[model samples]
Target: MTNNQRTEAVYIHIPFCTNKCFYCDFNSYVLKDQPVMDYLRALDHEMELTVKAHPPGAIKSIFVGGGTPTVLKPDEMEYFLHSVKRHFPVWSDDIEFSMEANPGTTDLEKLKVMREGGVNRISFGVQAFQNSLLSGIGRIHDTDDVYRSLDNARAAGFDNMSIDLMFGLPNQTLEMLAESVDKALELRLPHYSIYSLKVEENTLFHTMYQKNQLPLPDEEDELNMYLLLMERMKAAGYKQYEISNFAKPGYESRHNMTYWRNEDYYGLGAGAHGYINRQRHVNIKGVNPYNEAARTGLPRLESFEVSREEAMEDFLMVGLRVLDGISRTRFEQQFDASLDEVFKRPLSKMVSAGLLETTEDGYRLSSKGILFGNEVFAEFIGTLSAN
Candidate 1:
């Protein structure tokens, strides 16, 4: 019933931060001696120009994620949020507005500002509970700061909050992972996103990893961490809707579901990707280029088309990540080709290998395949009908 072309979700990327984390390679910069207000102005310009191309119909969810959205001063944040509200048309209902915050930077006053500015959900980057691990990961906020930040968020009347916790850090043990889970359960938020540490390119962690300075957990231990998290999350009455995300019923992230379900969404800000009107495009990464593009009333699109064959592959790949999988009726409607006709080989192989299973409504990844998803997905790659 939802209109994917006239998307109901939008993502705005804030690319400024106070400090970069050791493992972060996102397009965020240290806000030192930079024209912060000017960047906001450029972002505002981008929003206005970009929405003109798409039908800004009733947005159900808006997620402002970035280098650290809370790093903006109260007035700066006010301007930014207001800019978003002004440009994006919304449906007449309670909209889910979620923003990512860094713990050390967000305080009582700033959180209150966000709440008043129509932010209903807040996801804090409280990566770990131990101060030692926090420092090892190059996070400025310690355990105390995280506690204080959560308290501040609560006081600001933000109930639907989520905290991010990570496992598999350098030298992280099973005990430490348990402690993090226990600490998370104590706060008792409606949702939790638990991720394993990944050494990304151009990050300090990657350099340290190459030099053998970052002693990550062995493969078996890492697998143990995943197993432990799954068991604990289920025990805590949270559903493992996605590989790294757990949520209490009805508190699942609507914004993220837009991505995993392969629905259409508008991705604004530098280096953002969007899929609209059966075409996919990525915005320019350079701040200056994006600004100039916006000024010229043109989108800074690097690529413009996504093949129909590729779209079907994307549907399978992303839909398999969800617990409910894709709707067969919807697939038939979109492609005008039966799901079986389109992916007969891959589906048969997956089901035969016990990696995917056909349900009454559609197909879903099997439990074993959920644990080893990559191998299962790879079987579908080569055989896709080329557009």
Candidate 2:
């Protein structure tokens, strides 16, 4: 088979967590029973096979995401980093190497090891500031640990730092959300990813929601919180580049932008997803399954060829999630079809309904559209031939 001739991004998933958060649906397990060394070996074997076949280089970004990446010891971090450096073959200057950490699990030594190991960006998951809300969501860290971790990161010479915060939790209110944003802005980090709580099925939050025991803010309250956050973040001079992420100028996450821009990224680790050269595939889900497969070959993949029509819809859907909206030029360039020709029907309907507006080179969701984003996205689904 011919190799795909496309520049790609890399995502390395570390699936070991100190403990599971009630709201998390990610493929992470409690570390007690996990085979850490064996997992690493499996991951290394996968890397060897991938690099030998594809020889990935000119990499734009590498995001080491989690089940809490900081759960790995500093030395363990070194082993992984070294593997990445050897296999990916990145230039020293342009690459963005980002790692996600839970606030309580990081320390100065760990941060130092990571920074020196070539991790230029650090994103901490500091979900909420209030201890009451933190415990309510089953987060392992308190507010103090958040600040402490930040201090440790700064001391380790990480200038480009981002913190992930969440609002609209169980029993959370607009006022509380405002305070969370207020607290976050005070830190003056380069980037902040503030997301609303999403309770997915099979999680503890979902179970509570079914029993009517989940103390969630009502719909109106959630909308109020969302609007308030936009105002505050705008006033604070952070650009809402995406629905849930805000960053200072030039500090936007290049790694994540690859996803929002609907570009290819190699997703490594158990339960990771990838869209490489227009084919979408998922890695095996469980840790042991992934490990066993990688030592042999990647297993349990559900792979599909992305048809040209499906690609256009996908580009519109994921790219629209970026606050800047979808690029008509880019859609045409990628799929060899004009955006208008492909999405004329939904585009017209959405525009008439005041959901999307035409920009110079593309279209962006209007105020009403963002509020009802899912509804807007659904219009572009099914088939573009209806246009």
Candidate 3:
């Protein structure tokens, strides 16, 4: 592959959790009785096959995500990290290797193992600061666990850290969210990802909504919670780099930026999704199935090519999610066509409606548009022809 086409980002999925969260819909299973070692071996096989097939560039970012990456024992973590280095050994000097951890899961020993194995950044799932709220949402960690986990990470020589907070949960009030934000800021972490609760199908929240048992905050309350967070984060000197993410200067999540910028990345392990050379594939989801499949070849459930028109739509949709918006230069470079010339109608319409504003070389969401970003993004999807 050419320099521009070689994948530089990787996403590895660790599909075992001590327990599933009530609101989670990710492809993760309970840790008990699962073939953890077998799964790791299968992941190693997948990495070997992936590099042989695609031949990665010097990887710039690698993100290890759910069910909870920290649930792995020290030995397991070491083996997994070794396998990663063996396959994609070449790394960018400033590579960001991040692993998602659940609070209360990472002790000093395990964290030391992680840091020694090359993980530099840690993102803890500290959903809420209140113990009551934490239990209500099925989180296994309390506020104390959050503090202890951060301390452990720091003691193990990690300075780049982030914590996640959630808003718009069941029984979550504006005051509650405000309190959570205050506690999260008190940690003085470099980054924060604050998101609203979404009741997706197959989740406990979804079932409760069907039975009218979920006492979620009203729409107006949820909007207030979002506004409060944006104002608080800004006042605290963190940039709202993305709608949901806040960072201190250079601490923005580079791995996630690869996705927002619509760049190619390798997705390894069970149930992971990868995009390479305009083609996307999702691996087999089940643990045993993935292990069995990887014994022979890539454990892909499905893979397909992405058309140019569809790719353009995706560029606008995800790129606009970033506060920087879409760059005409990048759009042209990727598709060899003028951004304005192709999407003139929607661009003109959104700009005229005060939802989008022109930048020096691109268009971004206006302050007003940021509140209704989903509506603005909707105007681009399915609007292009395959030709």
Candidate 4:
């Protein structure tokens, strides 16, 4: 069995945005006429109840995500950050405090507020570097906003920064993606997360797709886009640490590593999901409902315990996403069982099929496996029984 230890990571959510993007299905509402302060107070209460129940360790990482966290007014941001420190008082000396921002939202004063509040890293949602693509995707900001925001972030004393880019966008071509990549690399940020667009349910993209209005790249074109990005990022000296994420050495996202490693973290605020002591819980999704629910207790929409078999499967599904792959010693430490013994069947089959290669530490996806990652991950799900 895994040893008992307090969680060392925290994730806070801010569910307000200036406007919802066409492709985004995240739990966020437009910022007009919303009870911003009331929501912050509710989040503060949630943090209080959480720490009292589980008692956090010296927090090694804190990531404040949102529809657009930088959209918060400076006063509201200050209040929220102060509350975070008050509840989880102890922090590691080198704690990674990250906040997600969007172009056109993070002005110099707002960013300085964030830095003063202990946010040391910023991830901007600069989906593409083209003005037409930005407008087509329902983004309010253009390429100019991207450059100006990066400049402001730097002026506000932020050097450790990252930006997101998208591939397989509607009406996007191989040439378009290449141009976006060139502009992104020009910024020379420490980290980059480039993802292929997925048409998830309840988003405008899904509606358009069903009506045959969305003109997304074809499958072959999408595959080429992924391959092109991998080669370019490698040539530019960025390591493809995960399938879609590339970073300079030691600049990987530590907060995300907690989830990939299947560790516990405190998830607070509306629409946030938290896993602690083997139990997972998702807070209420709606803003007013969440505010009301946190008044008395934990605002959990649903809570459940993760079974050992499921946890083991998850260990493979997420751990293998890292380029270095899961560690054998780490697996043994968590499950008190040998990695080879527990997953002998799937391990042997995958190795035989040439999708997974054995490492000195454990198992990782081969080059071919990276292209067909979904099939490899699907192999492990529901394959284990609760013995």
Candidate 5:
């Protein structure tokens, strides 16, 4: 593929995990007996071919997300990072290089290699502070492991760190969530991402839900959990930059913002998805198939151009996720039609219903709309079908 637009962000997916979580529907597999090295080499090859085809503008962000990137041994991590540096040689001076880690998987040696290899930020998957809750979710790490891992990460020269927490867990209570929040705030890390557990298809949680065996929190309790967390985060002085993410000033996740802003990015590795040159491409998902295909060429399972209408819908859906909302000028510039002209009906309806508040520059979710974001987003869908 030829392109004049310079891609500035890259997302690398690692498909191997120590163990799959009960609720995770992500494309990840358990790491035992897997062709780990071969997959890395294939990923290297994919990056080589991709950069050559699309080239790049000084990449501003690189996110290594996974089944668990830290699961790679020190030498393996070194080799993997070497391949990354070799392929995407040019990076901005302040490039946000981030890697996702599982608490139990990281050690001093591995973290040292990761830091020295250009990983400036580490996000640990510390789902909760309670040991029972941790095991209930199939996570190996307990509260103690969370502390040890953070200490090791800091010792390895990583001060830019973040931890992920989850609420509305099985058998979780309001008091338990409050304790988790208190512990997370006590860490005083630069960023924190707390999400509610969604029972997705093909996961253990889904099966349990089908059998009416999952002990999930009721709607009222879940809503209270969200409200409580937001209140706590604000009181603690972290900006609610995104619905699920909070950060100190200048510490928001630039890589994730790239997606919420509906910009193009290169997705590499098995089961990765990329949006470039107006088309979206998904790579072959299975590890073996991806490795084989990468040896020859792009391991793409599908690549299709995104329709203009579809792009507009995506712009509204994702842009609203950010606290800043969608820019009317940007929408007009991108589509060459006024945002009002394009989404007049939904815009009017949402505003009248107090779900959206119009600003001089754009439209954003009203305070009430933030709580009912899905409903607001749904209004934008299919509005262009009549056009």
Candidate 6:
């Protein structure tokens, strides 16, 4: 409860993938000819240095994300997982250790290593069920690979599982999205994350969009697709915990909730960003540079202490992503100021515009607000001037 309390969550990033997806702008590289084991060792070294600097409490959640964490070989996976366990020795009894995997990369042996190494949750990157759509997005696996991977994961004793799906894809139809959804629901998995495609810079899709080559769904079609999916998910008994994530009861992603709840967590690996002790740090991005820097000390690209005002803004921006919204008491507890007093103007404007509604303990996005969430979040930015 003190200012110096350690964070209870850890995020380890593995920036290697079998192949780069056309739409992905994540900090990951193709696995071919990369220094995979060396990077893992450097990751281990980074963890040791980090723990020494900021000793952790019992970890509640640990998430391993990346281009494709499953791309690691069985021995490599064991070494990386062992390093994690060794560095963060203390763990809660119900700790949620999750890893991101690509459908084609994970096999039975690899899944067994992950399961035996204490990874209880496996989130597969099965972006679409249709083969053509998958290829259009530069995804390596087909629909059959998805089913096989799920079977292997279940055989590996991972009951807590999730899959990532996408809509608004280039050349994608609403009916295609519906088919993907129906297939996803057929599995009856514990969690499902369906996201709309975003054409971020430096990606293949971005170039296609620039040249007007990307056949994307128009605004009206995309909106209808969103509404349809929301209705389908609701009817299927999934809770839309966050704007882009849904889950069965008691199966929500605790590790991601740590980020949405705006709590501190350690970020390891190249290009990983971590916020701890009121400061945020981003590691060096290149593989060689990160490994070299780790030998000397913390491989930090940038580290800055977060100001109180910045923290409050971040709390509102990220915390509001959750459907439950921000708690007034918790805000006051965190900043020692009334949330209403600090953000009265924007809150009033948004509430009046029917974008935000008052909750018993806090404020949450109205139904319309969820649709235009970016607009609502924009109102909070730069409202409070630094004193």
In model 6, the runs with Cα more than 4 Å from the true position are: 385-387
Residue pairs clashing, model 5: none
Residue pairs clashing in model 1 are 58-91
Candidate 2 lDDT tens digits, 1-387: 124565558898899998889999998998886888888888888878877756675887989997988888888878887888788866547788899999989899999989888899999998878899999888888999999999999999999999988877997877778888899999999899988889899899999999999998888888888889888999999999988889999999999899888888888888888777777888898889899899887654688888777777878888888889988778876877788876787899999999999899899989888888899889878766344
Best candidate per lDDT, number?
3
Candidate 5 TM-score to native: 0.98
Count of backbone clashes, every candidate in sequence: 1, 1, 0, 0, 0, 0
Put down candidate 1 lDDT per residue, 1-387, tens digits, no spaces: 134446788998888888989999998888877567777788888787677767677889999888888999999999988898888846448788999998888888889889988899999999888889999999999888888989999999999999999999997999999999999999999999999888999999999988989989999999899899899999999998887889999999999998887778888887778777666778877666666676666546676776678778888888788876667887877677788888888899889989888898789888888888878767766566542
What lDDT score goes with residue 244 in model 6?
95
Candidate 1, residue 315: Cα displacement in angstroms equals 0.6
By how many angstroms RMSD does model 1 differ from the true structure? 1.8
CA lDDT scores, all candidates in order: 0.84, 0.85, 0.94, 0.93, 0.92, 0.92
Write the residue-wise lDDT of candidate 3 on 1-387 in tens digits.
124577999999999998888899999999999999999999999999999999989999999998999999999999999999999999999999999999999999999999999999999999888888889989999888889999999999999999999998888888888999998999899999999899999998899999999999999998889999999999999999998999999999999999998899999999999999889899999999999999999999999988889989999999999998899999998889999999999999999999999999999999889899999999998889444
Per-candidate TM-scores read 0.95, 0.97, 0.98, 0.98, 0.98, 0.99
| Model 6 TM-score on a 0 to 1 scale | 0.99
For candidate 4, the lDDT comes to: 0.93
lDDT, candidate 1, residue 76? 94
Q: lDDT tens string, model 4, 1-387? A: 244688899999999999999999999999999999999999999999998898888999999998899989999999999999999989999999999999999999999999999999999999898899999999999988999999999999999999999999999999999999998999899999999999999999999999999999999999999999999999999999998899999999999999989998999999999988788899999999999999989999999998888988999999999888889999998988898998999889988988899999999999988988888888888888544
